[model samples]
Target chain A: MTEATHSAPAPSPSGFRLDRSSWAWVGVAPFLLFAVLFLIAPTFFLIIGAFQDADGHFTFRNISNLFQPSIIASYWISIQISAASAITGAIIGFFMAYAVVLGGLPRWLRPTLMTFSGVASNFAGLPLAFAFLATLGRTGLVTVFLVKWFDFNPYAHGFNLLSFWGLTITYLYFQIPLMVLILTPALDGLKKEWREASSILGASPWQYWRYVALPILWPSLLGTTLLLFANSFGAIATAYGLTGSSLNIVTILLYAQIRGDVLHDQNLGYALALGMILITGLSNGGYIWLRARSERWLR
Target chain B: MKTSKIGPWIAFTLGALYFIIPLIATFEFSLRLKRGEYSFEAYRIVLGDPRFQATFGYSTLLALATIVIGVLLVVPTAYWIQLRLPKLRPVVEFITLLPLVIPAIVLVFGYLKMYNSSSLLPLTSSPWSTNLLLTFGYVTLALPYMYRAVDTGLRAIDVRTLTEAAESLGAKWPTILFKVILPNVRSALLSGAFLTFAIVIGEFTMAALLDRPAFGPYLQLIGANRAYEPSALAIIAFFVTWACMGLIQVFGRGARGASPETR
Candidate 1:
């Protein structure tokens, strides 16, 4: 291909400048069209609609209407779920990666865990909810088995598989794996020489981690945690499948608003979606910023 | 070192238990269809049901269409960006990643209102257009993975040199892109296609909202109605996802991060 372009000097650079300049963009026109028509146009319509009144005139009514009790509670619950799941997933996944990379384990374990994480991370949404239901639901296998074996019921201890905590556990199925998938590479970026150098300087293991490893890893750790936060915040199918309309997280609430205008106001639904976009966008933006900062040192 | 080894073993065991127990429970629950005896009756019933066949077939076809559309759109754009329009790479990348930041339900919400019957374009007025809209939605959802894979593939081969070589041979732009560029990125495209297939096959929100007959909604419907079939369906879904991931691992091996040339 390179040779062909070099050899094809039929159209001299000075003669074809006008045509070349215009032709260059033609290659990307289809991509731009698709993005505008599908992605940007739809989101733009919603953002504009969020400020419009029922009669399609500009107004602040919808934005103000987002301060309602039900709507606020929905956002609160969504934040809690995202925070809880992201923190748990980050901690456990970091430890898991740490174990494999620094734990003096077998060589094959890293690839094995990585492959499993790939599957598990994508193994989310509806089937994941069902899997957790089968394992932890009221009449689920482990629930029944626990009753039979230990004469104790998990439900009796307020461990319903469709509540706030239950949803967090379900979200962790994908969240933890995603964390492991991302953090493994970051963890691998940790140099063995740094660890050895720290220990040779009479630094204890805890002191070494606190000084050298933790300082280098905090950016990736925090950035990935923010990413996990946004991931769970946008997720709906698992929660919807597990709890139905019983749990009023923001995603499911927006879903209800979309399906039936359960909010009784069309424009409020637009505002709801706009709010969701803002929250998730902020987290992702933060993730990218932190990653760029951390990668500077790693590079 | 002593505590580090012990810590990893404990973490590995717990992680394995957390990940594996769900599959075991689902499979075990799927078998208790005879009230007292373990059997494959649930799987039999699910496989026999016409609704299952219809929804699964519909989703499979939708997934195939999504893959084709994704490839047709992504391959050329990625190649062009890497070869010609390097300045637009950041803009293209940001747009591709937008779908991830914007939730599927919310994006579909934007679609429902913007293209509804009363809207300007009214994409949902006809069933075929609604299907087209849903396909576009899948493309948007799958854009991140597809673009990343193709871009990575483009980086692996010498894009500018390949384009120049193909041009020097008197080949047209289409031939250069399709014949020369596409084959070099075959494995990456396959990896992306498999990931997109897994995503589209069991997707519930878009299909349900669009009123399409898809496997995801069917599974949810069965879960709401039946007891055991849902678990059976879950197992099947897990199996399909596992196969897709396995294929991705197979095709994507050694093609990620640093290019083969660099290695």
Candidate 2:
């Protein structure tokens, strides 16, 4: 492709010299059109519907509906679940990343971990829901084990697979892998020399990591954590698949409200959409902030 | 060089077990068939089922169509934004990323509402249009991968000189795109195509919602009724997804970390 082109950065016809030609936009035209029509338009429709009533009259009802207590409870529940999963995912990922990269595991384990990360990370939605069900559902192996050993049942013990805790556990399947994938690069970024130099200077292992390594890793760690938060926050499939339409989590609620054939509650559905958008948006914003911070640190 | 600490090793073993046990149990349970004896009967059941055969066919065709159209649409769009409209990259990129925020279930629901045949534009219902919508949905998914692939390919090579050189020789835009640019980014295209295929094959919500007989819906149907066979089907689906992704990785030759172009 570059056979005919000059290797050096050549000035353009304009007085202000741009390096390469600026005709790449031609290729982007078709996709851009698709984006506007499919994505942008639908999003606009969703957003606009929030401020409008079932009768199509524009109103502030949807915005006000967001601050209601039940709505508030759903938000709080989602926040807590997302928070717990993100923290656990980050912590476990940190250990796994450290061990896999630095531990005594065989060299072949790296690609296995990578490939498993792909399968496990993409292993959400329905099959994972059923996988958990087969293991922990009422007729599940774990439930049966619990019964035989301790005379326990999940319903009596309150180990609700149809609840927030179950959702979080299922979410971790993907979250941990995603965190590892994002953080492995950061883990690799921890130069061996930095650790060696610190250790050689008579610093203890804990002290070296605490003072030096932690400082270096802070940005990538933060950025990756925020990315994890966004990833988990935007996920609807896991929650939906695990509990069906029973749970009132934000995404599931939004899905139900939108599909409200009986109530015909268009405005309320939009309000729920707003909740999802804001939740995901905040995490995305945090991701961008940390990413920029990490770039600056790297530079 | 240092010997591994016992503590972290134990923790990882436990964690890895937690991750692996379900897959193993799922496999073991699937192998249990006909009075719960260990057998390949479940596999025979799932593979031999008529619905499975039909759904698998539709799913493959849907995935292939999406990949081809997705690559064609995304590569050009990514190429356009990266090479031609650099000033509007953010705007274009933002639009492309809408699929991530707007979940497929949500969008498909919206599409069902918006693009119904009897409304707005006059169009007839056909497998072609149904495939188009299905492809369109999958393309949005494949979009980010497609975008990233083409964008990376663009970044790896000098675009201006190639285009100018082609133009100087009186080569048209399409020729430059197909002959020079597309071939350069073929690996990227295939990688995106593979991802599109993987996601589309297992996608249940859209097919279920659209009432289209794709593989995802087939799995759902089997899952609700036949237990062991569904587990077998799950394994097959997993391997299919794995093989599809492996093919993409092989073809892409290090195409990971690239952006997917979305609609």
Candidate 3:
């Protein structure tokens, strides 16, 4: 650490050049302390506690208990919802972004959509749940109108607004906008020169999208989809507000376990949170990796 | 060209419908407080309720506290890193981004365990301490936004040159930070502050678990029991979010700020 002392000979504050270097480290101490206490320590505590029995003895009992049928079902259902919403959001958001940026439309439309997308994406949680309920619930405007006007009963057709499909659709309320907000910039990165070059090379529009556009856009598209997956994976408020605890997604299940230890084991709750962190962490980590890869090409 | 226009319009229209219909439905439902006619009775009822005022007031204060703490913690740290510790940028960024990856529920769950009554710090030992804990949790949740915003703001201005100039003029560290650096990044800080306010207001899981009388829990409570009022509350919540987003847009655009929408 003192190797650089000769380079900073002008520093005489503490009569030791090494102390100047340490001042730089000291400047960040408060931030490090805050992060560790509130953020890192809490997470580390959970991970450590997950491996301990109720009496603080080290054990793998909680990890093994995670394989139970109910817990497995919760994880499965949560994954299903996340995948459904993310893929659906990505496809629609991509096309919407593409249309606004490349498709022949009013120039004002892109900014308008982008701004609305910003609001809509942030407009999640309880009120978002209510908005969907009002739109799709049994006596909701659309539902009632469909029943009264067209004699089409969605419920009789086995379409409930509180089921897996309903939750996925509800999740899309924010997911699609989030997709639009993210994909627009990525779409903007598509150079017009690339298209021109493709056309000059006798490539059809289909061929351009297939060989050039999709290749450049794939990393961003996949990364954003992964982000959306993590976004919904850990989302508890929207699902909780929409279906209450009845949805049985991992987040809500974890919420129940935290609230009352419904899992019948205190250690298992830590494991549940650990599993959640792992899933979201992996997806977000994947997103960052893919984003870095895409950014390299774009640059 | 005409055919291309058709496809784009169709996509835009479909996307708009998907977004707009629910809002329309929600507004219409909120007006259903009158049995035989449209009325703002639900709005009146919700606004008239004491619980609404109390929780909303509690959350607003909490949001303000979070913003002050978040800005104070993020700005100096971000500025310091930019000027003195560029090598640690990626590590700082990773730590800031941790909250996004680790769900709020998980973080709060950890908080419940690590700071509960019997823990070392025992943050949950009292209601006031729990509120402080929730404030810190909000700070954690807002860390990514706050740090990125201030860092970008700092980047926009020349941190090294400004600090060097201030030092040459015999300005102290506090004076340099407060008068020179902070004023330059005021817009970015406002942008971050607005976003943090928006997040803290509608936050549910953390506040609910922490047993605070925040707007999120109150909204959830009303949604569970009532019908039209929930819709009304939803619209109000939506408006608050919209207003915050709008403020960010105006301020962000003015500041020429860099904020990661996806993250």
Candidate 4:
């Protein structure tokens, strides 16, 4: 925003001087070429393809096919999962961050927790799925323990690893830590003095956080949760590996369409991909907007 | 009732315990040769696997490629824009950050569809082409981090005065660029390079889409097929990320215009 506000200076160059700092454009060349060829053009190609028929004339048939009953289940399942994951991740992240920073954790353990949280937040995806499986899957120790001692049955009880809820549980391994990492730094801006000021004024702990801290943190917490929401929205590897595309998540569905038989036509798949892009895109856009607005206050 | 000093201590312990539990489970998972016997067989299998040999090397090479490209392009552009063309900062910042706004999976999906053929300039075939695409993707991804690092460093020192002093003394753009400004912003470049390297190493979605066997995809592949190898790979990856992060910390600690690495 500020860049356009500045006045351009007269140009000069020593050693391999270019005619203009549009040469800065040259520095941008490789990224430009990559984005145009790889990212921009192909995506528009999908959009255009979605609007066009097999003969390549524009039509809404592809769009209409998007809402057919066979596919409608996918939308329902995906939205539910995204909502569940987002809420679960946000709550866990807020608590852990609160515990670490505000709940007054011991000094040595805070950094250790922070570092471990950093690693754990990055720890999910494909690797996490298998780790969780080893612990919880049939023939696994924990499963065997429950089966023998508690008379539990994953299949009978619908505690199956391949279930929708199963994937959400797997997602928390990272989502909680991710929420912790992003929200912790923002919480730092709350400062001890503000809490002390609230307490000195006779505010209860709940009141201090409710009035003083929450207001300051509302934008960041919302923004960070949105980011976590967006992250799980696009998550493909974990669910894809865990359930082998049986999970009916949007990403898994798209991967199936791209790789093989999940849909009738490829173009319909592109539209579905577009749906994922647009939804996740809007969430991310909102996150960045809130983050930018809170930057001066938070950073 | 008056054990108030234990309050923060208890919270930190619980948080730390929650964080380390999964990792400990992973360590146990990786160490189990069988139910009763503990062993390093998983690590042995991972190290001995030929795919691990090739893919791990490939991933390292890919990360280096990304860092080199990130440094080469971002350093000059960040400096030139920040110093000579401050007006272009916002535009440059916007262009650099397009990657951050667009999710990697979506953008890389776009790239794959766009550049799958030979007609495009600089287009190549699988793995190499994919790696090249990744290098560009990473640089773009890296731009926001790198530019901020260098920009902050440049702002910390007066780039205008340095450029003028060099220009008056007959130092050409290259000399001033090479000797004065770059050295001054070396910490930023180091920080940027370190951060870029970490992102590249851990990147899975792009590499998987482009069909390269980088570390992230390797983890996905191993995790799907084997029980324990994934744990080994994850630990290795965690260490690599930790080392890169540590390097960035070192780079961040040094004086601007000086090397951050210990002599």
Best by DockQ: 1
lDDT of 4 by residue, A145-242 (tens): 67899998675677877777887877877787778878888888887788788888998887987998888888888887788787787777777667
Candidate-wise lDDT, in order: 0.88, 0.71, 0.88, 0.69
Task: Evaluate model 2 with DockQ and give the value.
Answer: 0.33
Give the chain B TM-score achieved by candidate 2.
Answer: 0.89
Ranking by lDDT: 3, 1, 2, 4
Give the winner by lDDT: 1 or 2: 1
B199 in model 4: Cα distance from truth in Å?
3.2
Q: What TM-score would candidate 2 get against the native?
A: 0.87
How many Å off is the CA of B172 in candidate 2? 2.7
Over A55-166, each residue of candidate 1 has an lDDT whose tens digit, in order, gives: 9999999999999999999999999999999999999999899888878889899889988998999988888988899999988989999999999998999888899899
> Which residue pairs collide, candidate 3?
none
RMSD (CA, Å), candidate 3 to true, equals 3.5
Better of 2 and 4 by TM-score: 2
The local lDDT score (0 to 100) that residue A216 gets in candidate 4 is 82
Model 3 residue B175 lDDT?
Answer: 76
Tell me the interface RMSD of model 2, in angstroms: 4.6
Candidate 2, residue B225: lDDT: 65
